[model samples]
Each structure stands twice: as C-alpha cells, then as structure tokens.
Target: MSAQETVALVLAQAPVPPQDPGGQGEDFGKSSPLGLVLLIVFAIAVVFLIRSMTKHLKKLPVVFDEEKANAAAPAHVKRAEAEAAKRAEDSEATETPEPEETSSKPSQAKTD
Candidate 1:
C-alpha cells in the first residue's frame, strides 16, 4: 500500500539479468586484422605528410629579414646591386626628357 512496499513488490517480481561467467567474454579484448591494416595505412600517410612538409620548409629562405640578409651578402654581390641601381637610375633619367625638348620637336616639325 505504501510507496516503499509497492516499489519492493515490483522489484521482487522483476526478471533478473544473466551474469557473465567470468570477467570477459569469448571475443573480449580481441582486434581484427582490418584494424591493424588501417593503423598501418594512417602511419604511412603521416610519414609522407611529414616528409612533404619538411621539403617545403627547406625551400623557404633561411632569413626572413631583408636588411640582415643584405648586410651578410658578399662584397661582389653588394657592388653588383649598387651598379644595377645606378643603371636603373640612369635609364629613368634618360627616359624622362625636359618639357622644352618636346616643345622644340613639335615647333621644328611645323617649320618643316
């Protein structure tokens, strides 16, 4: 009639679950060959990925700082850079003529 008695009566009539004979079943703690094959495949993929990453990293510049890299360059390389810069400046100067030159060319063409 009471809540405790009703619960006890229901629990007493409930079917009991079967217990295992020992700690483990027949196939417990066993692994299939497919699992081993998959593990090996993943390991090989990781190795290849690491090798590719290392190769890409090796292709990058040793020093990211341009100033330090330039300062560490050889004397001949520095001289070559200076000469190239001078040549570029000279080419720019020659490419850009005074406005007077353009005016004189048009006037000479009109006279001719």
Candidate 2:
C-alpha cells in the first residue's frame, strides 16, 4: 500500500544468488568408484569431442560459407559449370544461322 511496503515486497520477491563458495554444495559423505568411473568416462568423452572439433575446424577455411563450402570447396563448382554451359549454349545459338532458301522457286514464282 505504501512505497516502503512495495520496496520491501520487491526486495523479498527478488531471487538471492547462492552465497556458497561455489563448491559442490552437497556433502555426499565421500567419493565412490562409480562416481570416479563416470567422471573419467565423461572426461574422455570431452577430450574426444574436443579432438573431433579441432579436426573439422582445421579442415574449414577462415571465411566459411555453408552454401559455398559444399564438399569443402573454395567456390561453387556447380555454379561455374552451369555458367559455362549457359555460355556455350548462347555461343552455339549465335554461331549457327538458319539455312538459306537455295531453291529457285522464288525466281520462278517471280517470273510467272
């Protein structure tokens, strides 16, 4: 109802951060072989994940593009091939002309 009450309510509603020393927080009494084994397995998994990531990262270029980096190529070879094909088709279309009217039908028709 009052500013002081509202401030107190907001302060109470706000979540408090953990004041613990950021330790495991739980006192599992002591360690066990299963926990150690699980930890070692997870550690091995993390190492493998890091190695795999490094391998793939080394294969990738500094400036990578998914659409252009297909099959790890620098440029789009398919696009270049398509452009070459299109140019060849255009040149073929322009290089050849229609057949001429070799017959004397036009001259005969004119004379008639």
Candidate 3:
C-alpha cells in the first residue's frame, strides 16, 4: 500500500473524542478553592522567606577581609568596633588573679 492510502485508512479508523454538550462542563480548566488557598499560602511563605533573607543579609559584614573593612569602615561600624574594644579592655582589666596558697609544713626525704 502507498503511504497516502495507509495514512487515510489510519485516519478513518481513529476514534473521535466525545465533546461536552452545550458547554455544560464549567468545572473544566477551573481551579478549586483549595488550590487558591494553597497559592495564597505559598505567596505568604515566599514573602516571609524574602524578609528573613534580607535580615540575615543585613547582619553580614560588607567585606570578609578585616584589614580592608577596618580601612574603609563607616562611622557607625567604627563606633561599634571602638565600643566593643573598650568593653573587652574593661573586662580584662577588671579580672583579678587568685592568690596562691603556701603550705607551712616542711617536706621530708623518703629513703628506700
């Protein structure tokens, strides 16, 4: 058989799909209320995640190199570092060394 005749026979034998009468299938291609609720929940989650990411990003230093960051430190950062250094110095200066105890008893030599 020729290709054209074979194709024609196959087309003739194909079953036709049933169509909705009077377009009564309104539910077709329509999302359910649950789907709408899920979409809203996902949007809210995305917004919260973005806010959290922004907060975390703000906590990060502008530069990872300490020398470079200090060289180009902004006024606020410089003030914060100064306060931290002062606090450390005060803590170290306020720490007291414990006094060592001396025993009054004399040591005796052991003979084997």
Candidate 4:
C-alpha cells in the first residue's frame, strides 16, 4: 500500500478511546446528562416530601393521654365536691335564722 493509504488506514482503525484490557465497556453504559438531572430532581422531591410530612405532623394535634387523665380525674372530682359543699354551707349560713330559745318559765305553781 502507498504511504498515504497506509496512514489513512491507521487513522481510521484507531478506536475513539483505547479499550480496557478486560473489555468491560459493553457492560458499563455511559451516564447521560438527562439521567443525572432526573436523579437530582428525584432527590429534591424526596427532601421536600420529607419536610412537608414533618410539618404536617407538627400541625396535627396529639391524642389525649388517657392514663394521665384517669390519674388526675379523681383529684378534680374531689376538688369540685369540696367547692360545692363550701358554697352550700355558705349559702345556708347566710339565709337561715338562729333558732329562738323557747323555755317555759318555771311553773309559778309548785306541783302538788
């Protein structure tokens, strides 16, 4: 082959990039810009979702603590009863008159 033709053949035969000795290029595909963008978008969406869920949880009202309520309920009832008794006693004392002392004068006449 002429020198010019030999040089052309060599240039054409050269691989775009030298292949690994193990020839693993076929198994590993190149990552694309679109794929990277999609990954980033997915990551951001997950973060936002987590943040929104946390905020929503914070907004939710907690359930009443039944055990604590049960423990405190007796004390509250007792206090209410005491207050009612005190009010009743106060009202009774204010509105009622003292009993009149009724004693028959010693019988002037002595019993036979």
Candidate 5:
C-alpha cells in the first residue's frame, strides 16, 4: 500500500521486447511500373481534351459584339436585312410573303 512498495512491485514485472526493424529496399518509384504508365496515360488524356476544346472554341468570335449589334439595329434596318436574306434564298426570283411576327405571350389567356 506504500509508495515505495508499489514502485518496487511495478518494476519487478518482466519488460516487453521491441519489434524487429523493417527491411529497406529500392525506392517506391523504381519498384512500380504500373504507376508510371497510369501517370503518362492520364497526362496524355488531359492534353488531348484541352486541345479539342480549344479547336471547338476557335469556331466562334473572340468577341461576341456582332450578335449584340445585330439585335440592337433599327426596325427598318432589320426588315431590310431580312428582305435581303429572303431574296438571296429565292428559287425563281418571284415575290415572297413576309414572315409574321411571333408573340412571346400565349394567345388564349391574353384577354384575362
């Protein structure tokens, strides 16, 4: 029950042995070929996707100002442009009816 007796009892027990050291060998990078192959394949796929995206993006304007300019044109200018386009598409050069204006609202519930 005394402190000195407790210390002596604790120190009298047998001690556990330390574990053996692990065997060291070649580096991890030199030990595996599959890891290197996977790394190369992933790098190539990333490069290919980036190139494909760049090619697709080049088909459009660098600045999209032309579309906004067309939308902001005066009504008369828009009509003239549409008529010119229609004339260019005519088969026999005969007169063609004008395209009707499309409404954004539904026709039936407009009165309500």
Candidate 6:
C-alpha cells in the first residue's frame, strides 16, 4: 500500500538464477556448411543476373521503329548504326588537320 512497504516486500523476494556467462550455443557458425554453400551460390547467381541485365540494357534501342525489324536493320541495331554514323561524322570533323597558308617569298620593305 505504502511506497516503503512495497520496496521492503520486493527486496524480500528471492533472486532468479544467474545465467551462463557463455551466451553463444557451441554450434553457432558451424551449424551448417550447406547453408554457406547455398549463400555463395545465391550470391553468384545474383551477380550473373545483374551482369546479364546490364548487358541487355547496354544493347537496348534508343529509338523504336517496328518496320525496321523487318527491313535491313532491327530497331536496336538501327539505333547503334545511327550512333556509329554520328560518331564518325564528329570524329571526321574534329580529326581533319587544317592546312596552313604559306607564301614562298618574304615581302621586302622598299626604302624611300
């Protein structure tokens, strides 16, 4: 009923058993080699899946044309071709060296 009486009653109760200091069960990580092998396999599969998806994404069409698939080039193929053509044009424009105009004779100054 009173705070002092409640405190005395709680203190009079027997304490619970002290638990083992060594908390870990002996077979913790050593439980299953099969689980580790499965985890490794899963990780490898995920890596392969990610790599395949990235490769597929890299080969994707930048532009779409349904008829192109029936023609000489597919949509993705045509997009790659267009990009190649653009790069070629840019390289050609930038790569060509401009010729310097040169006169064979130096101009002589006429003294009056």
User: Candidate 5 regions off by >4 Å?
Assistant: 1-31, 66-112
Backbone clashes in model 5, listed as residue pairs: none
Estimate, for each residue in 1-112, the C-alpha lDDT of model 2 and write its tens digit: 9999999999889577886755656764678889999999999999999999999989867886776657655457778978999999999988967799899766644553
Better of 4 and 5 by TM-score: 5
1-112: candidate 3 lDDT, tens digit per residue: 9999999999899687668755659776788999999999999999999999999999888769978768878999899989999999999999999987587888889999
Which portions of model 1 show Cα errors greater than 4 Å?
1-3, 9-15, 18-24, 66-112
- In order, what lDDT does every prediction score? 0.88, 0.83, 0.90, 0.84, 0.82, 0.84
Best by lDDT: 3
- Global CA lDDT computed for model 6: 0.84
What's the TM for model 3?
Answer: 0.42
Quote each prediction's TM-score. 0.44, 0.36, 0.42, 0.32, 0.36, 0.37
Model 4 TM: 0.32
Q: Give each prediction's root-mean-square deviation over alpha carbons.
A: 15.6, 16.9, 16.2, 30.7, 14.6, 18.9
Model 1, span 1-112: residue lDDT tens = 9999999999899676658745577888899999999999999999999999999999778869999889889999999999999999999988966565444444434553
lDDT of 3 at 111: 100
Stretches off by above 4 angstroms in model 6 are 1-7, 11-14, 18-23, 29-31, 62-112
* Model 3, C-alpha of 82: deviation from truth (Å): 26
What would the per-residue lDDT of candidate 5 be over residues 15-94, giving only the tens digit for each residue? 77555334433442264778789999999999999999999999766677988879878999999999989887785477
Q: Residue pairs in steric clash, candidate 1?
A: none
Best by TM-score: 1
